[model samples]
Target: MTAAIELHHVTKRFGRRTAVEDLTLTVPIGEVFGLLGHNGAGKSTAIGMMLGQVWPTAGQVRIHGWDVATQRTRALARVGAIFETPAFYEYLSGLRNLEIFSSYTAPVSQRRLAEVLDWVGLTGREHSAVRTYSHGMRARLALAQALLPHPDLLILDEPGEGLDPEGVHELRQMLQRLHRELGLTLLISSHQLGEMEQLCTRIAVLRQGRKVFEGPWDRVQWAEGPIRLEARPFERAVAGLQAVGLVLEAGRDAEGGWVRPAPGITPDQLARWIVEAGFDLLELRRPRQTLEQFYLSLMRPDPQSDSRSDSREVTRRPAAT
Candidate 1:
């Protein structure tokens, strides 16, 4: 099956500044893919190129096999996007704004407009002027406008921006329904790492205009995390573990310390080693690394070198013995 979106060696430069560099990405149909990075990380530039709003300096972008640069209309025919903050003519009714926007592509039927309004939970407010709507309500209207095209793929740039916890929750639930019920492919770019952690099936992280990591969410979990160990005779247990080649970092409390076990060492092995060494093994467990931690780790400077390394190649660091 053709991918929902594809970019091959896409590069964008503005004067002397490079916005995106050699970005090659593919978002398969029915997948919720995330584009993550800090501010000025080239996410917006890449998205703009995909939408044909920003021309790339090099390479090509395609949407479901249609070249965005050469066949923009067809490439975007099945794509809907809420890029940056959605704007509307505040003097017009919500329904009126959607009608005008929909006409730009192809006039949508009244029934279709009603269906989209209902889908975004703006059924009753459709007749109200956009200026009267709150931030959340306006967001719903923007979403309704996107859905007006009956798009197969949805691209959202910071959908949760300016939304409160409840509003964000509603947006998440709505996006889930769109993917589940309509089978729409989604490309979301956001700074809400927690939200992305919940929504994205696969993710690509961009650092300074280049992709540093791209893979399934579970792939990030394979990185080695600290193991919490609690054993009686704390001093002896610590010394014995170190003697056995386990690297230990002092814990917050005195009860236990954190261990970064060397490659080929398991928690079970650590427990066995402790027990056999005459320490009473009280606790042993590896804490799961959250997406935020993984992301921060990627952003941290590598202690061994000043150069940047591909995250995929070194996501899992070997434990020092």
Candidate 2:
């Protein structure tokens, strides 16, 4: 079956600098795929190429089996994107703005327009002038406009930017509902790792325009469990843990020390050792690894480690193109 989106060894260059290098990726249908990287990591360039706004220097990008380079309209007909800050006439009502934008694409019925507004929770505010709308409301309006085409794929670039916690929550819920109800394929690029962790099924991490890691969310490799150990008489607990060679190094969290057990040494064993040493084993459990930890490790790998040599500094671009 044709992938929902595919990039075959794609590369994009601007002047002497390459924005994206030898990128090859595929987003399966019905998947929430995340494109992640620090600023100037070529995320915007890749998205531009995928949307056929920027021509690639080498390789091909396809959407629903249509080549974006040569078949932009046909390919893009099935795709809706918010490539940057969504723009609408500030003087116009939300409904009027959508009506104007929809006219440029395909004619959408008024009923369908109402449905889209309702889907984005903008039903009552449809008649409100965009100048009066909050950032969250504008985002919802942008989403409503994207849905006007009834697209099979939605590409959102930092859709949650500037949203309050509640607004972000609402947007997440709305996207999840759309994915469930319409089987929509989402290609999202964002700095919000926490939100991406909550939304995406698969991810690709980029650095210096190169893809360093790509895989399902559950497949990220972790070296040590973030096992937390809380015990009475903290100094003794720390000493006992180090003496047994279980605590490799102190972790950043304040509440408990992390354990790096020797071979065949398990959490149960460590707890036993702590208890046998006469310290109260208050708590012992491996907390779930967060995406931030994984992302940091991938972006800034230790020089002493041989695991990943491709990791680089995570910094924003001086100026984005």
Candidate 3:
């Protein structure tokens, strides 16, 4: 099947500075794919390229088999997006704003408009002026507008921005239902790691415009590194592990120590070794890896490189309305 989205060696440069560097990615149909990166990590640029708002300096970007460069109108017809802060005509009523928006696209019925507004929890607020709406209300309005066309693919960049806890929870629940009932393909980019853990099934992390990790959430949670153990006779267990040539780092917490086992060492082997040494194993598991931890590890600058350079952030283009 053709991918819902594809970027092959996509590179974007602004004059002397490179914003996105030879990045490639794929998102399949009916999947919630996440794009994670630090500020100025080229996430916004990459997303802009996908949305056909910014032209790539090199390579190609495609949406559902349509090349965005050559078939932007066709590709975008099937896409709905809220990039960065959603902009709307503040003077107009929410209903009127949506009417103007839909006028530029395919004509939508009143019934359809009502359905979408209700879907986004903006039912009665449709007649109210946009300027009177709170941040959360405006966000819901933007979402309602995006769903007006019943897009097959929805792209949201920092959807949780400016949302309060309740607003965030509501947004999550709404999107979850939409994705489930409509089988919509969603591409979300955000800094909210915990929210991403709940929303995305698969994710890709980018650092300095290059992909550092890409896989299912479970694989990312169990990424390779160290296994932590809280076993009895801690001193003896540590000594035994060291005797076997496995490097162990003392755990920051009181539970146990973390072991970076030898190349051929498996968890099972370590368990046997612990048993043989007469240490009662209380807990033996890989250190739980959150999305935030995984992202930080990738973004960590090399000790050999100048640390000052890591603090410099690239400016991204304004988000498309």
Candidate 4:
């Protein structure tokens, strides 16, 4: 099948600075492909160019094999967007905002409006003016609007930004349903790595205007296993991993060590191993590998140490003194 989205050597610049540089990516049809990156990493800029809002300074952007520059409307015809903070006439009811948005594409029917609201769990609240809706409710309305056209490709920018824990959970389930049932090609990005971990099938990491990593989400090198770890003296315990040759990129905490345990290695075993190696175990906790940890590990510099050389140097230092 043809890719849902493709970028070939795509570059974008604003005056003196390049927001996206030499980026090349291809997302397959019906795949929930994630563009992972910190702010200013060109994720939004790349998506904007695809939306025909900003033209790329260099290279090409295509949606469903239709170049955004040449086939602007045709390419966009298959697309739907939900901005970071969507604009709606607050005075209008939830259903009214979605109804107005629907007019941008096809002629709307009352049945279609009701169906979209129900799909997004806003069927009953469809009559409530948008101003009274919570962040999550607003998101549902935005989503309901996006779905009205039955878009072939959906690009959602931080769609879950303001949701509470339960709301976020609900959104995740809804997106999964959209992908599984609707067969919609999705390009969704969010700052919440944990949610992305559960939602996206593939991921791409962008850093400082460049694409650093891209591929299946499962293929990203996490530097450790699946579980998150919290241990007392997390830093020191992480340091101890060196003695045994087990590697982990642990985040430091005053209360303990936070680790994504090595696959096949339990948190307790890691803690016991740390203690056996001559360090007092304050704590060792295992948490899941979030999109945050996966992205962060890609950004961190590797730890390189030569124990033999260090010992020799230390021995020489004492002799010289």
TM-scores for every predicted model: 0.81, 0.76, 0.80, 0.73
Cand. 2 TM to true fold: 0.76
Candidate 2 has which clashing residue pairs, if any? none
Candidate 2: residue 294 lDDT (0-100): 72
Model 3 segments beyond 4 Å from truth? 229-254, 257-282, 303-321
Say which candidate scores most in lDDT: 1
Question: Which of the predicted structures, 1 or 4, would earn the higher TM-score when compared with the native?
Answer: 1
Per-residue lDDT tens digits for candidate 4, residues 1-321, read: 779999999999999999998888888998898887888888899899889899999999989999999999788887889888888999998877877878877778999888888888887888888899988888888888889988988999888887889988998898899899989989988888888888888888777778777777654423334334444555666767745556545564454335544446666687678777766665443333556666665655445543211211001110100
lDDT of 2 by residue, 30-59 (tens): 999999999999998999999998999999
Q: Which one wins by lDDT: 1 or 2? A: 1
Model 1 regions more than 4 Å off: 222-286, 303-314, 317-321
Instruction: Give a tens-digit lDDT track for model 1, residues 144-213.
Output: 8888888999999888899999999999989988889999999999999998888888888888898887
- After superposition of all CA atoms, the RMSD between model 1 and the true structure is 4.3
User: Which residue pairs show collisions in model 1?
Assistant: none
* Each model's lDDT: 0.84, 0.81, 0.81, 0.76
Q: Number of the top candidate by TM-score?
A: 1
Instruction: Score residue 23 of candidate 1 by CA lDDT.
Output: 86
The predicted structure with the larger lDDT, 1 or 4, is 1
